[model samples]
Target chain A: MKKVMSVLLIGLLSACASDTTKPTATAEDRSAAPAAAASAAVTSAVTNPNLNPILTDPKNILSKRSVYFDYDSYVVKNEYRSLVQAHAQYLRDNAGARVMLQGNADERGSREYNLALGQKRADSVRSAMTLSGAKESQIEAVSLGEEKPRATGHDEASWAENRRTDIRYQGE
Target chain B: MLMRSHQSSRHTLTLAFLLWLTSMPLQAALDIEIFGGGATQISIAITPFATEEKLKQSITAIVAADLQRTGLFRLVDSSGPALRDPRQIVYPDWKNRGADALLIGSTVMLPDGRVEIGFHLMDVAKQVQLFDHTITVPADRLRAVAHQIADIIYERLTGDVGVFSSRIAYVMKQGNKYALQVADADGFNAQSIIEYGEPIISPAWSPDGTQIAYVSFENKKPVVYVQTLATRARKAVANFKGSNSAPAWSPDGKKLAVVLSLQGGSQIFLINADGSGLQRLSQSSGIDTEPNFSPDGQSIIFTSDRGGSPQIYRMLVAGVASGTAERLTFEGSYNVSPHHSRDGKSFTFVHRNGARFNVAVQDLATRQVQLLTDSRFDESPSPAPNDRMILYATEVKGRGILAVVSSDGKTRQELSMQAGDIREPAWGPLPRVR
Candidate 1:
């Protein structure tokens, strides 16, 4: 029991350190640093249990509606953890409030492949949400593929913006 | 716990390596944008066919257009003189006018309310008759007869079967209405197979040329439907719980490979012609879609991101458990929408170079990849039945249009519509025996 607590303390300290220095890091470093922070966020949310206030607050991380992903990847970054955690907590708090996760891919591959990749991305978010306390029944995941892109240019900047998952409330 | 961490680290290293490789500038390969045919084009002169004053169609004009559109023949100006009768042909005059071949024909009204068309293909260089034929048909079939004559001349010169008699199907979007249209290879006689407010895409023609399988969004979601050309009747073959798209017909026309999201993600599934025998062919943790059958029907090729980036892979058609899929493309980070050549010797697909996507052909034997088009966004390449030309969709000034490139990458032609975007061109099979 003592060893387990020490290991957890070390992980929490490293995650906090990575979060502070993320802005100056390279893209690769930034991507790797997020996982620790996300796990820490997930752990804290499980302990607090009251997530409705943070989720509905406009200034809180849970209000962030989109989770951006790396090119050709569906893995959720650690930086988006607080946002995903807040939603997961809210779902656990409010049983009737349901949300849908729409996955999207950049316009870079075959349409069918994009659709599949989008679904994978959305499912990844759903997995994260479920792990953070959201019930599987409270979340619906779908893929709009490249058909519904947030940005329409054929450049990297647009593609980065387009590769994301948008969280929406029911009837919104 | 140690094993899991080791595996995760290895996966991250692999992704980092992929990013590094994709960032490297690809070697400058044979990337050429072909605008039109070259000077080696065969020159031929076609004189106006002798017809009654009331005749509504010009057979000679149709023949001239057909031959010219191939980018293989150059039509010498036929306005010099009217040589409707073969007896009045001065071979020396035509030869001096830079004509290697001369075609003269006459159309006569038969007593049985039919039209009799007679034509003779003369080799101007050899000063000898190459072909002579006569056909009697109703007036409505005159255009087809003209195409037949063009095919004969084309075969005599090039020794390859002509595709002038074949047709191409595509999706045309006009205003709020989207239509699945079939048109002559030259973009004439366009007939709408189906029309809807939602989009229609991924048109695939059956090997026998009697049916087309396509994806329609009529049900507020994507669904695969196969429609018989003659009856215009269609039934949804893949209307599962999730999206069903990217339908490809097998060579023998017994099965179709489609992408379904029923179980999760996108996976390749096979279904019978009548929507029976539903079996999953691909099992992947990542996206595995856009399945195409090999010409021999022994293997299937599809796009998958199991390796962290989209690439083309080929596996036996027996089943996924039968054997593992072998990756076929490594030169680029992105390659998809593969269509095997009719001869099974090569395949064409969309390859991305930097920000631009172009059509490329890969030889299975040599594994040589050749870029065929120099477009910013080229997709959905469908090789003609003869494998001599490839039709693909590309963007022109923000509008989608269909373009054809010869297999040699020496000639190109753009087929555009005035009203809306044209996309997802599928070259139909050869005409069936009547």
Candidate 2:
């Protein structure tokens, strides 16, 4: 776990700048598939297992799926930058990988408004990932709103957990 | 702290529950627990109709419960003399029993099996008849006929149009399955219109009460669909590249104002009822959703964050393409889900300050804001057709349930199912003059 953290820190420091840029799916960028680089990453994923794994290891940042938000906010915070960048790099490394970003809100405000807020949260994460090197077409953003809650309590701690965008790869 | 006032009779309560289940595919019935009443309730007594015991349902029992649910009418002892002929009755007897008004009816079973109800409403002080009516309906329509009687009494006494005969649509989620349901305003005779595995929200009844438009995530994305209530036929009215939700029917019922993210931000758009002629209505930089058409159909009030924080804004229908927007709410930094009242005088919405979100109503002319509920979490403030009540969803004991707060914020009632969460309540318009 310590070794993985040190390696992720170096990767974060190098790619942090691009992670904050606005994601523009340009025509040239659409054609640039990075197929050769992906094949190499896939080979190393089997032999080395650092760049990509099945995501069961708790030490791997990719294992953390949720990006929580403050009340009535959709901005991706600075704390989750490394976590998002790790998954973005994983998506960039694996071409066939498809991801779904399900946004959610606490049980506050109108359901429709919360749904839109949830979508914005999911879109925020999608923008961060696509800008960090993930393909724009690889991610699908949707909102669960407050329908599904991680914790059903009405306290702040439960509401904090519910206001999130979950990153679920295809299948799992 | 809200008090739970159960019905006066337990038998009628069971039948109401049975009626709700008999209409649907046998699910849990939403038990209504009334809380607060009007400042001065109208004391009225509904006596058992002569020969009503011969029928399957007691007309007086159904009528009594409907009146009691409003919290505006107090049901007095009705075991007094009940007669179809009012000339033989003594009005002073009811006055001595602490009753200001009296309702008496008699049931006539026709040979062909239809039932005819002849009822009379009498004022104890005036000693004169207020309303007299004779209604004939099929045997299966006993509940409907009972509700109609309640409506007539409500309108005559309160001067406000009665909503007892109308229905309400909401989303009920049980375990993994979610169902869009429609029920009578009193929370009886519920029937599921659409059932799916995914989440459903924002049910807007068409102006005519014949159809409903809602957002369903069955396709894994929010898409607006309009379903006809009669034949159960439906079509996707808005399925754009991105999220399509927050459907509001125009007063004319020809077009729908919806929120879409087609241009990268949630903006208001107009589409025909049959899902044609899509036109963008409101153009805003920040998020703009939850559009509600005014009663006159001239403008719309929607929730927008263009002014830095979420607030309610009103814009003309013609001005949205390229015109100015008017902000309606200024009391709070967070306000959304604005719903116009039937008279178009005021709008009800969710107002949040700090962490407390409450249902609030604001006058369109005066702009005076009044928070209706002090509950922790409240949403979806849908006013009754007569503007006498506002139905919304709030959290009680960490469970999602529907609440009805009086327009003045005095009376409140909680409607909850035996299990599962009930949310997104949209009150239907008055049942067409029938």
> Which candidate tops lDDT?
2
Query: CA lDDT, every prediction?
Result: 0.73, 0.77
Cα lDDT of model 2 by residue, B101-176, tens digit: 8888899999999999999999888989998989888998988998888988998888878888999998888877
DockQ, all models:
0.08, 0.12
Clash pairs for candidate 1: A34-A78
lDDT of 2 at B107: 93
Give candidate 2's TM-score: 0.80
- Place model 1 in a CAPRI quality band: incorrect
Top-scoring candidate (TM-score): 2
Please identify model 2 stretches exceeding 4 Å from their true place.
A1-65, A70-73, A86-98, A133-138, A168-172, B1-41, B319-323, B353-355
C-alpha displacement of B152 in model 2, angstroms? 1.5
